[model samples]
Target: MAGRAIVVTSGKGGVGKTTTTANVGTGLALAGRKVVLVDADIGLRNLDVVMGLENRIVYDLVEVIEGHCELRKALIRHKQLDNLYLLPTAQTREKDAVTPEQMRDLVAELREEFDYVLIDSPAGIEHGFRNAIAGATEALIVTTPEVTAVRDADRVIGMLEAYDVKDPGLIINRIRPDMVRRGDMLDIDDVIDILRIDLVGIVPDDQDIIVATNRGEPIVLDQRTRAGQAYQNIARRIEGEEVPFRELAESSFVNRLRRLVGIGNKRRKAN
Candidate 1:
């Protein structure tokens, strides 16, 4: 079967669209799939830096689109993973440098060679965002549990529906279980009630994600990180595996005791 093209997007900034893209691409590649992560932000490009391929970018997407370089010349292979590649964006060029038609063509060409093409979309429903979603077979909407992020995600979902994008899934990032338990934050049910999309993954807020990003490495590379495990789960879910959602509750002993008591009560009720 031909590879699938997916766009990782969010309507609001700092909601982890780029981070999700980097980790998902890395996870998929680690699964033995040939994946190409395209940075669609153009002048505001950061996926290259997140993937640690910034210094090796000789020809960017704009250069390939404008015929200044061949497509093969623009792709930078990952240092450790042979299946992973990055098509970096030109920081010198603006969003208008490449049109939606050009992006479609570029993705079509990539589809022939890659098992997955993950587009890292820039935030907002603007020209850059349009170019990113133009050729996507599906979209993965990334959002936080905050009201502002959920509201923006709803707006982006509406726009994608208007554009007729298929099977757009939701990834709720940086969810705090303690806040949810304390009624201080929006929980998963609350987010699902508002968005009304198939849930792809839930990533808890983790400090390692920050350190990994700062070190120009995707969190998925660190197998011990909870956030990295979440990303891997998402990649597996994307591959059509029926992986269950991770338990995002606090690991207090009292919480475990309560669970045990609840199970005992349930057994008695069954009897």
Candidate 2:
């Protein structure tokens, strides 16, 4: 059977879309699935660096699409995971360099060899975004708990619907429990109310993500970080496993409040 082609996209920038792609792809590979990470952000590619295979990129997506090199020649195998590979994009080419039809065809080809093909989309609603989702059979929309990010995600959801890519799942990233408890940020329920999509994964605000990125390591490989576990859960869910979502960190203030209210033993489930 052909594999799945999922585009990891966020309409707004700086919402951990690329990071989510890297970690989830890595997580899927760790699950023993043959996976490929396609950097669809042509002119501003970063998936290779995030996968720690930037030095091994001899060819790129454009080169493969344009017939400059074979598909296997452009794929950079991950150092740690033999089943994980990355198809980097050409930094010198524009989004227009690869047409939507070309992307669709490329994804179809990848599906024949890999169990999963995760495309990292550029941040926008323009040509780059169009090219990114061209071949996607499914989509994961990444958004932070901020108002602007949620609003942009809503817009992207509508656009995806128009393009016949229905039921795109949502991945809420960088949620701070302290802020939510203080009413200084949007809660999970608030974001879900606004977007009204299926929730795939919820990643907590973890500092280790930055440290891992700087070292060219995907956070999913760490095993100790909450964000890494969240990504792994996403991968498991993708594999048709029923993994329960984990509770995010609760603020000390909430604990104190629960003690003061004499309900400290009460438990609440993750939304």
lDDT of each: 0.89, 0.89
Candidate 1 clash pair list: none
| lDDT of model number 2 | 0.89
**Model 1 worst lDDT run, 10 consecutive residues:** 262-271
Instruction: List ranges where model 2 is wrong by over 4 Å.
Output: 249-271
Per-residue lDDT value at 205 in model 1 = 87
- For candidate 1, give the lDDT of residue 73: 92
What is the overall TM-score of model 2 with all chains considered together? Answer: 0.91
Residue 142 alpha-carbon offset, candidate 1, angstroms: 0.3
